[model samples]
Target: MLPSTYRDLLRTPGAAAFFLTAAVGRVGIAMTSLGIVWLVHGRTGSYALAGLVAGGFAVAEAVAGPQLGRLIDRYGQGRVLPPVLAAHAASVLALLVLVAEGRPGWLMAAAGAAAGASIPQLGALSAARWSALLRDGRAAELPSGFALESLANGLAYLAGPVLVSAVGAGGRPEVGSVLAAGLVVGGGLALAAQRRTAPPPAVTGPRTARSKASAAVGPRAGRSLVRPGFVVLAGLNLAIGVFFGAMQVSVAAFAVEHGVPGAAAPLYAASSCGGLLTGWLYGLRRWRAAPRVQLVVGTAALALGCVPLLVAGSLPGMGVSVALTGMAVPPILVVATVLTEATVHRHVLTQAFTWLNSASAAGSAVAAAASGQAVDAFGAHGGIAIAAAATTAMAALAAAGSRTFGPPAAKRGGGFGSSAPKRGGNFGRSGGV
Candidate 1:
């Protein structure tokens, strides 16, 4: 049975509709990311091109994220999300047409660039929306919501590819393309339903106001997203990213080298399973404990979890290491997320989220190449050890810099509820960055 908080919150205003809409839409977006690569790769017969295709999405997303987040903060999500998703959907369709029509690789890459740049900021917006909802509602349900959302996000990764693979087994190249489209439309509709539920725009207090102003004119200007606490978290996250990204490439390379490439699946599955369990469990942990406590513990555990990876010389061993390490991820991410919402002034919240997106992408981009090279130079054990060290260091840093993230603004404490925000598109209620 669903809990009282969730059921009650959804029943109010447009919150319920938005929640349903987002979940539905996310499923589609998730599939695009998970399965699109294999589909493109299978057709192109060039891993380099495939990598470029994949990298293009990351680059576009990373480069454009802050602007997208800013737009959401400035204009509201409903105004921006649809068109972006549509453009993305159209690009995927165009790419499929090009492939079917025998277009050159350059053409496909070009098409990919357009699609990638325009991909909706749905992930961040959805997260922010949830944060907004939680800040204004009952605090008890807040943790559970984050936990459920993380699990759902992971499930999207797990299921997107499996579903695509299952559908493709019937020998239809267009199957993946069609599935991607269906998901886009479905997700788009779901997102649309939740439009009314967006919390009132966060109003910037003097601190954020001064920060924003200084960002425009001062020596340290132009980085409105870099709040001190946010900086600490982001810095730590970058290290974490390096660790995870390196592991992602290195793990695959290690398995393939050992002639047991299939073994990677078990480790990956174990990680996801652990993430699923931890996400849900953390919700029951009670939100009253200091956010930093959660942040520190989660990150420390995560770093420690990576320690096992250093000793794993085989598939089963790797799976155990991976699962244990995976346990630390959801909590770290969820804690960071909740903190970002709770602390950063509302006006700049979206920007902070985008900065995070950029961090993840940048980290992945660096890791993809560096990890492979490290493994080549030092062997898998060396590479894994390095990954663990970096991850642990990040956790320690987050612990040291924990003080910057203050308690939530009193007005912003619970998040949005069943009541429609009094000022539609006002973008001034919660507070700005």
Candidate 2:
């Protein structure tokens, strides 16, 4: 059964609508890269070209995400989302047409880039809205809300590829691409329409020192990327991404080595299932540990969990190991989100979250290349080793810079890591879970 916390969250007026829309949009976003690969590979019969196209798309999105996020933060979601989504839809259609007509690979890649550049950072935007809605009084609910977003992300990735595969089974990969495009456009528009839920445009009036500093730095200066806390979080997320990318490739290679290539899907699904279950559980309880403490613990657990992959000789062993590793994933993300919301100025919160996403995407790209090389040279074990090392790096970073992740002194009382009296609820109190 769904927990009461989540139930209460959904009961918040306008929450259910935006959450559902964001989920749909996120699923579409997940499908896009795979959909591009399928479509291009089907049309060109060249895995290399398909990979190139998909890589271009990923790079484009990573590059453009923070900038788009800045615009959203500055102008507000209702004003910014519509035009961006429209561009995304148009670019997707262009990519589909290019694939159908057997256009040059570079041209197809360009279309994909256009599509990627316009993709909305819905997860980050949604988190920003939650911050706006709950920060004043219901701040304790923030972790649960972040956990729910992370769960949505995990589910999207888990289901997106399967849906793409199923939809493209008829050999018309373009159909899946079309479906992905439709969901993104439709969901984004619906989310935009929920104006009441969207965070207001950042007020840049010269009322405070921060605002004055932002003004001094020029219009684009208050970007979350410039902050040290954001940098720390981005590095941690990048390491997490390395773990993800390496795991994906290594698990497949392991399945192939065991002469059960099809087992890869189930093995990977085990990890996702584990993450989903634990993410829900993590959200249900109030924790005594600070967000920084939770982050360090989560990263350490993730590193240790990957250790089993090195020794797992059988498919089932690998599944168990990956599942354990996955259990640590969501809590880390939830903690990161909490810390980000606490540390970043609310005006730039959306940009901060999107920058984290961009960091993870960049890390995934780097890890994919490195893991592919390792797998080719040292087999699946090499990739698994890389995964473990990445998580270990994440743990090291978290421990070394734990102080940097602390919320501002003022926010500590009612939010994460506070010992003060609870104003809204017991969600952030230091105690049992």
Candidate 3:
């Protein structure tokens, strides 16, 4: 009933095309952020300036994310993505040139902002494709589909750094920016070409010209902002991001204090590996718990898992603790995506997703800055304690607003229900247990 491996997902028509396309975009996402930081720091010789440029890039993305998503929702991926990718690539190239030529800081910031504003929302769009393609009667397949996407995202983070290191060898940081731009152009185009998976444009009533244009704009007119459920989801994602950011710095500080700074990457990779394994197994299950309950329980457990990090003095102990904590991360993300899918309207899914992403990004940025200061003042233990506290707060919020996550599909009477009238034709009947 569920895909055992990603290969099973690949066998589904159009799934392979879209997944591979998403992988390309994910790789670009993973490389570009790190690449920009390295390039700016190397050229400017000031960590402050580097941080400022990187912050500008992220801030621009946070500001423009939902607006770009709304455009994609209104115009279709094919029409919207190509121009955006072109602009994004152009902006990156401009940044690359400015850094290479040692241009002033303001110009660099402007270029970084442009790059962020034009960057495509590949993850959100990919998830939306899966939701649209697997809807109607194949609802049971949705979990496996989302799990595969999550796994791909994890793999991207792992592989993207390797690509950046290879390209930026011998301190050639500019090379990574070029490579990242290439990935964006090639991947974005390929993803946009999968028109079969693209969500259909919003339906419009035949009437006044103004009404037609408004309908075309649809979610762009700010419908998603008015929803309380979506706002809560955004806050939840932000908390998760803060937890992740603090944990990351804490782990790095731990490695450095123990005189094996290089071990930090391996320790982080161990956690990602745990997440990847759990995500695969999770997709194969037919769960009894509602998604909202799962979210609350999972977040609480994750918070508790972080407790070990504070006491894990040895490197191996810290690695073990990190891996255990990471096992909870993928499921939380998968559950969040599922809830967003269920709660938001179809027309505004991209916008809703972008809002969640923006919130998370902002939280991570704040945590990274704050945790660094804490680590400097009070050591790695302080950072770990802070991370645990943030996770605890996240758990509390999840517990209080579990209802916003929405009821599970099985319990909602519309999905794989025991008494749902057999509809959706061949796909529906074939998927029936």
Residues 1-433, candidate 3: write the lDDT tens digits: 4434557757778989987887888788788877888889877787777777878888998889888988777667888899899899889989988987889999998999999898877888888787777776665566667777788788888888888877666688888888887887888899999898777655333586865875865634355445555666777888888888888899999999999999999999899899889887877665556666677888999999988887898999999999999898888887777767666666676777788888888888889888999999999988888888888988988888865544223325553212111233111100000
Stronger candidate by TM-score (1 vs 2):
2
Sort all candidates by lDDT, best to worst: 2, 3, 1
Better of 1 and 2 by lDDT: 2
Candidate 3: where are CA atoms >4 Å away?
Answer: 1-5, 203-221, 407-433
- Candidates' TM-scores? 0.83, 0.91, 0.89
| Residue range 39-148, candidate 2, lDDT tens digits | 99998899999998898889899899988988887768988899999899999999988888988999998998998899988888777777767756666677778887
Which lDDT tens digits does candidate 1 get at residues 379-412? 7766676678778788888889877765334333
lDDT of 3: 0.77
Worst 10 residues of 2 by lDDT: 424-433
**Which residue pairs collide in model 2, if any?**
288-430, 288-431
lDDT against the true structure, per candidate, is: 0.65, 0.81, 0.77
Candidate 1 local distance difference test against the native: 0.65
Best by TM-score: 2
Instruction: Judge candidate 3 at residue 220 and give its lDDT.
Output: 47
